[model samples]
Target: MPQGPNGYDLTVMHPFRGARYKDSVATNGRYWAGPLTHFAINTATYLFTYHFFANYSTEYPDGFLSEQTLKSFEGVSGERGSFKWKHGAERIPENWYRRQPGNDYGILNFALDAVGALQALPYMAVIGGNTGEPNTFTGVNIADLTGGVFNAATLLEGNNAMCFAFQAVHSAAPDILKGLLGNVVLAVSKLTDALDPILAQLGCPQMAKYDKSLLAKFPGAGAGL
Candidate 1:
């Protein structure tokens, strides 16, 4: 049986069959490996499709802010206006418009719109109905798997935070000041490991044990993400 990221046996992913009699010849040889192989292949194909779409889509938009509004905020802050959230939906804040500046509001709006459009393209292509598109799969629309409708409020809040962080980093003093700030951030990251035991005690999700076998491969198989 194949082991998962946490060293647990993946019984469902790879089931074992009992020993066969020597006189009995298996008629369906493909049945043994076919399903698992196809599952892996299909999974790999979809994952690659998702990665390619995500990387290429974000590159074209430049900043989270669109081209039309980006020029307005170019010199206002030395920071790059086009920051993107890795987990876009989760990072968005609840209230954005009321607290952020006017220019920031525009930039946030542009970023949200661009992200929404770019994200939707892959979903549409993979599961969109018969709209005469080349890559669309008419069988079933799985766009909802991506997420629900875009929440402008949450997106704005997240973008505002992202832009603010970028601006703060850009505006920070050089030399000793920057070095101190870097050290603080590094310390915080290192200390985060200490919280794992506390979180586990509180019944929160605990970190998975590192698997050396997955050193150069994807580390999320059977992780139940």
Candidate 2:
């Protein structure tokens, strides 16, 4: 039987998949016990959690990726120097020391910037950047670039839909049971949205072509990668 108007079944959807992956580290400790193991496991776990959470964050309810103000720390070294309190004495002239930018060694920022660069490649190619013209580069073509765009856009749409749906249900739920039911709905919606492209590629006719009318209703639908 269907669980909602969308005919989605909630039983198979795993909304807590991120939490499960995080928990698995503790449950299966042997897998994360070697050198660089923590790095590998934590990377995978954080990726999943970030994907599931999408743009939602308790601290930043409006969105998570906002422009950060660059912080300056010009006098850090002199402030922490050993001889700063000597009366009438020139504070240690830490000429070799310099203030560091907050994002100077931000690993997360570097990774995010790299991903952003990769995502912009297709657009750059369209605007005459050297992504290799169609048939010019052996084994590389425009379809591959467009397909990547399509897949990325689909995934983004899925994430957005999941976040919007979750927020709607979460806001209206009056009690614990209703909240649980809302979560179930959210899980199903998220799974279905995410799998739509895969199912379409697998020859599901209904999933292959999106309805133009529906697209009119949802502007984000136009961003079909």
Question: For this target, which candidate reaches the highest lDDT against the unseen true structure?
Answer: 2
Question: lDDT by residue for model 1 over 113-187, one digit each (tens)?
Answer: 333332433221121122232222122211122132212232223232222222222222232144456575555
> 190, model 2: CA deviation in Å?
36
- Cα lDDT listed for each candidate: 0.26, 0.28
Candidate 2, residue 90: the lDDT equals 30
RMSD values, in order shown: 22.4, 21.8
Q: Which candidate is the best by TM-score?
A: 1
For every model in order, what is the number of clashing pairs?
3, 0
Worst 10 residues of 1 by lDDT: 16-25
Whole-model alpha-carbon lDDT for candidate 1: 0.26
Off by over 4 Å in 2: 1-102, 123-135, 138-225
Candidate 2 lDDT over residue span 103-204, tens digit each: 132333323432332233322111111112221211112223232333334422323222222222232233323445657666656655765554443332
**Candidate 1 off by > 4 Å:** 1-66, 75-190, 193-204, 217-225
**How many residue pairs in model 2 have overlapping backbones?**
0
